[model samples]
Target: MSSLLPRLHALWTKETLALLRDRHGLAALFVMPVIFILVMTMALHDAFMPGASIDVAYAVVDLDNSPQSQALVRRLDKSGSFRRIAVGQDLDAARQGIRENQYALVLGLPAKFGERLLAPAGADGQPTEPLTLLVDPTLNPALQLAFRNQTAAALGTIRADELTRRAGKLFGLPVSPAAERDWPDEIVSIAVQNQRSIRPPSSVQQNVPAWLVFAMFFVVIPIASIFIIERQEGTLQRLRAIGLPFGHILAGKLLPFFVVNQLQAVLMVLVGMFIVPMLGGEALHMPAGRSLIHWWLVAASVSLAAVAFALLVASLTRTSQQAVVVGGVGNILMGAVGGIMVPKFMMPAAMQRLAEWSPMAWGLDGFHTVMLRQGGFDAILPDLLKLLTFAALSLTAAVWLNRSSQP
Candidate 1:
């Protein structure tokens, strides 16, 4: 045992020295992932936060150039939600804007909008036709909802004021119905308040931290491939022949990478917390106090899973090139399935169900619990357990395979 210990120590020392000497390998292990985090985060930012100023060019076709119709158009313009490109009498221009995605919503005041509003109700006491709002359904659903709500509220206020004036005239009241009722003022104020209350965080906030977690956690497999290369080159054989125990050798080879992975994790969190904000990204929604434990558990579990996956890849592949190709492809596939490429909410139900088999899914879920839900350790316990089980199973397979591969 003592002899084996010395051999293991020597092998570990040699592997550590080689890794430290290989600057290129270390850079690949660390630097490339950081670059990927930055790039991918930026690319995906718009999908999550779409609130960052989209230039919406809209046209208003006012068939009724009455004071009320003009006032409605003015209200839309004053809201600052859209840029009125042309206040023309051309409906074709408005349709062109819709086709070009230049305008998401088009306001077309019908030729008799003013006359219809002022006309008395028919025998049934209902207006002949309700005001029509033309909006592009192809646009973002949230934006559509916003526009619909705002326009509806605005039109409702206008209708109410008109009704109140008609009522005042019928009752012979001295109150100037439009002047006495502040419906438009109240409705507009309410709409503005609603917009402020639901303001979404920036794109960077929504994407950077998630991508950083993914990019950093994925490097484990490639780093583990180093072991496969060493094995293929008979380095493991030589070390084993010198009496090194398998466990010690595996531990030593993985130590540096484990450290690197943890550091990458830390960098990602720190950047998400601090640096992303400087880049006009929202601050990372890290849980405070008690919830920190859950996040820590999540990180530890992910790291363990990474290490296990690396060892499994090293065990399964016979050559360094094969390990790299297989591991890299596997990483991407796992990431895609696990909600790294697309959010789980956007995925099909079957795909979401299938994602349970992916370690990345577990990692991302844990992160969501910590960041999005502000969950504590208990909330992420199931994910931690799953990851640990996966790690243990993979490590066991790796150990058995490594032993079987030996002469």
Candidate 2:
């Protein structure tokens, strides 16, 4: 037992020294993720935010020019979410603006919008012309729905105001047009998490963990490089000759890289908390108390999955070049599907379902459960189970592959 410990210690020392010498591998492990986090966080700053001013411009065509029509326009502008651009009153000109890419949407108030302000669509036995929203076909469907919803909200308020004014007059009660000018109808968005209210995750919150998961899986580069080199130089054979089991060799690779992945987690978290905010991005917030422990549990599970997956890649490949190509391409593919390159929330329904199969996705989901949802260990159990199960399976495959390759 004592001899086994000493041998494992020597293997760990050898791995640490080998990794230190691989400058390119070290940079891939650390430098690449920092750049991705900073760039993507700043670029996507407003995307995940609620009530961030949208850059997509829309034009309103007031066909009626009535007080009610003009009032509706004013209400929409006051919402301050979508920018309202001025377009010529001509309907054809508005359509041309959309075609020319001048604006993405145009809201046209139909004639008699004020006269039918209190009328239902067919209450008077004549169908009322509804508001028209002409949109550029290329515009995001989400943005289209947002504008439609904002207009509906504004119209509902207008209808409520007109109803109140008419009811006051009928009851011989004094009412003024200005009385309902500013309705306290603004909706405040609060993200519900852990039975508490907080803002939704900022860009840094997303990019940090996402790119960090991507970076963790990148241990495959260094692991495969070193493994292929050992095999080529007969270092692995020498170790096997000295009575070291394949499990010990795999354990040696796992521990050092596992520690490296944790260092990566700490460094990336510090970058998100301190560095990103300095670069004009929101700082990441971490959970406190037991939630922090849950976060670490997730990080540890991810590290195990990452290192084990690396070992599997190292076992499968025969050369350093093959390792690089295979490991690099594999990490990219995993990141692409795993919500690293693009957020899962933004993915199509089919794509999101596919993400459920990615180990990186499980890790990211675990981190998000703790950090974003303020979840306890119970909340992250499913993802942790997925990652750890993946690690066990990968490590088993790696050991089997190595043993089968032996003469």
**Reference-based lDDT, residue 195, model 2:** 78
| Displacement of the residue 201 alpha carbon in candidate 1, Å | 6.7
User: Candidate 2's residue-wise lDDT over 216-260, tens digit each?
Assistant: 999999999989889999999998887888888888888999999
Against the true structure, candidate 2 reaches a TM-score of: 0.85
Worst 10-residue lDDT window, candidate 2? 177-186
Deviation of model 1 at 53, angstroms? 5.5
- For lDDT, the strongest prediction is 2
Give the poorly placed runs of model 2, Cα more than 4 Å off.
Answer: 1-10, 85-103, 110-112, 116-138, 167-173, 178-186, 347-353
